[model samples]
Target: MARNSGRVGDLPPPPEPLAVPAVDAHCHLDLMDASVDEAIAAALAVGITRMVTVGIDLPTSRWQAEIAAAHPEVRAAVAIHPNEAAAGVDEATFEALTALARADGVVAVGETGLDYYRTPPEQHAAQQESFRRHIAIAKDTGRALMIHDREAHEDTLRILAEEGAPERVVFHAFSGDAEMAKVCADAGYVMSFAGNVTFKNAEALREAAAVAPQDLLLVETDAPYLTPVPWRGRPGGPYLVPLTLRLLAQTRGTAVDEFAAAIAANAERTFGPW
Candidate 1:
């Protein structure tokens, strides 16, 4: 994964901490400008104390595991992302990725669902195949399945059902509207919202947020991508989670502290003891 370019006006000072600490259900610390320790410290300072650093490829997956192993606050989710899976990646590499998924402190096998948005039509087969493989790994290892569903919502859901989704399935940076939220809610999938849920124009997402069961809701930064409103287009970090969590809380009409606590509990349920 490419690191965020710390261009002028990109990295902003950390926002005020949340009233109570909350977990960042998904993130990509390896893709940010901060080192693992630096990112962890910054996040901890803001009550974003625990996070799952996701992998988009084998090397980064291994790096994610390494960071998780070294830091109690960080857990890892390893997988070859849908876009990367479409690239001529070999089976041996997937075997290696599966090994990484099973490593100590590796809580999930994911960010691997379907992405019709960026991948070409010709490569959809490859992406779906890789997704199935990741599903198997998640099930076999008894780890949560972290999904990255973009425009391929139907196929993503279909494939999960076809393969018998792992007991713990997370829709990382969930991009669905209320209808899809209903489907996920009925299927018992955790919908992890990122900063985009705060956009003024994202009423649909906010509606979906409201539809999600409180126990099934989660939060993330997806930094340095989806930086929340007021700081949109700026590079994001875990410390900025309060902005998104507050927005989610407001959308759900819950107190910020209570919402944060629910998210923390949901985090443990989805990813296990991290």
Candidate 2:
């Protein structure tokens, strides 16, 4: 899962630091190449003051909590990612995640939801069941829900409705068009765009960004994956958030500082004060 393979190299030199600080709404510190401390420092230098590191499995969930516990600038989001759900979430895994959901500095339960892209039809049922349980966990703990919807937008929205979403819901690396963005807009869900939104072929994603209400806007690295354009194939970290943020502001015809301030506020509203 680590693109940097456990060693931090020269990441694309960071883009210009935003005048107003922002938060990396979704990140995977555990899977990244940099040491946790290095990642935090790099992000801070670029005005990405806080990060919510999400987990995709039991071991990684525990690591998320631990990282949050050790760093003031980091918050933790715990869940079994939908892809990981294919293997099934047994009792022990569920119980541990529930407990982690209530841990201090644990601000969310997610990187959950559905991912039909890589999963097969036989496992769709399992992913859905796991997603439902995660929704309940988020509600029970009164934490935000971070969803990872990948090529399963319809089912993801449906399950959220059936199970009832938490007070705060964020679609991490939101991969939807303007129409889907409207649906999320109407639902008052936060849509966190990532570096991929800057890709030349991601017109639909850009359209979604253009139409999304400022209050619903958020940005992340989803690193170390989907590194922003001009630096796409490079291993990424929280520090690269500025590239995506600037592009989103430009697409929406909004001032960079104003856009940056709004997104920072949204992150606080969705994940609480970091």
Best by lDDT: 2
Model 2 ranges with Cα > 4 A deviation: 1-9
RMSD of each: 1.5, 1.8
Residues 1-274, candidate 1: write the lDDT tens digits.
3476453365778888987889988888887877777888999998998999898998888988998998999999999999898865688987898778889999999889888999999999999999999999999889999999999999999999999999999999999999999999999999999999999899999999998999999999998788898988888888889999999898889999999999999998888886
Whole-model Cα lDDT of every candidate shown, in order: 0.89, 0.92
Tens-digit lDDT string for candidate 2 (1-274) = 2435443345789789989999899999977787898899999999999999989998898888988999999999999999999878898888889998999999999989999899999999999999999999999999999999999999999999998888999999999999999999999999999999999999999999999999998999999888998988888999999999999999999999999999889989998887
- Alpha-carbon lDDT of model 1: 0.89
| Worst 10-residue lDDT window, candidate 1 | 1-10
TM-score of 1: 0.96
CA shift of 101, model 1, Å: 1.0
